[model samples]
Target: MFIISLTYKTSLENVERYIPGHNLFLQKYYDSGQFIASGRKEPRTGGIIIANAQSMNEAEQIISEDPFYIHQIAEYEITEFIPTKYNENFKIFIED
Candidate 1:
């Protein structure tokens, strides 16, 4: 899995302008089963996305399709991790 962390590079106004398109991009990935979960940060500075891509390159390629990335409205930091232990309900997202 990959954790994509987005930090606003411009202003909130700039970020808001691309939200609609960003949402659409998110939906596309969700429909394809690439995205697991996503939402805004606590202070609303940016957002986070959990993705189930096969590799770092795949994750980056997926993120490249995001509107926020296209407009350079935010900077993305991707962290890859393996799920050692998770809730039974969340097992569907984990691959052995």
Candidate 2:
């Protein structure tokens, strides 16, 4: 799993301009089962995405397609992790 953090590099006005398109991009990945969940961060400075991919390279490629990245509106930091423990409801997230 990958935890993708998006930190806004542009003004909120600029970010809002691309939100619609960004949402569409997110939906595409969601439909394909690449993205597990995503949403704005507290205080709305940026956003975060939980994604499932074969490798970091794959995750990066997926994030690169996001409108925020494509338009350079936000900077992304990706962290890959192995889930050692979680609620039973989250078991599917760790399973291959």
Candidate 3:
């Protein structure tokens, strides 16, 4: 599933505060092979995370760990995506 997370900043400090949690969460997912792809949205806006998980419950577990959730720094739209024809070479970015 692909989870697209967005943030509405009440203050820049809130955004800063949320960084730690986001970093930790991303590290966990990326390290665990759950994150297929992720990056900051354009104009340095929002977050886009592509995840592969066993179930929605597992996905939620990943979401709950994000720093944005801890600081209330962003809002997210978590959705389940069925990739019809994902380009393996173009889309895949697995760093070892």
Q: Candidate 1: where is the Cα deviation over 4 Å?
A: none
Query: Could you give candidate 3's per-residue lDDT for residues 17-37 as a string of tens digits?
Result: 667767888888889888877
lDDT of 3 at 71: 65
- Per-residue error for 83 in candidate 2, Å, reads 0.6
RMSD to the hidden true structure, all candidates:
0.9, 0.8, 3.6
Give per-model TM-scores: 0.96, 0.95, 0.77
Better of 1 and 3 by TM-score: 1
Candidate that beats the other on lDDT, 1 or 3, i.e. the better one: 1
Candidate-wise lDDT, in order? 0.94, 0.93, 0.74
Q: Provide backbone clash counts, one per model.
A: 0, 0, 2
Candidate 2: 10-residue stretch with minimal lDDT: 87-96
Instruction: Kindly list the per-residue Cα lDDT of model 2 for residues 1-96, writing each as its tens digit.
Output: 999999999999999999999999999999998888999999989999999888999998998888899999999999999889899998877887
Whole-model lDDT, model 3: 0.74
- Per residue, candidate 1 scores C-alpha lDDT tens digits across 4-81 of 999999999989999999999999999998899999998999999999999999999988988899999999999999
Ranking by TM-score: 1, 2, 3
RMSD of 1: 0.9
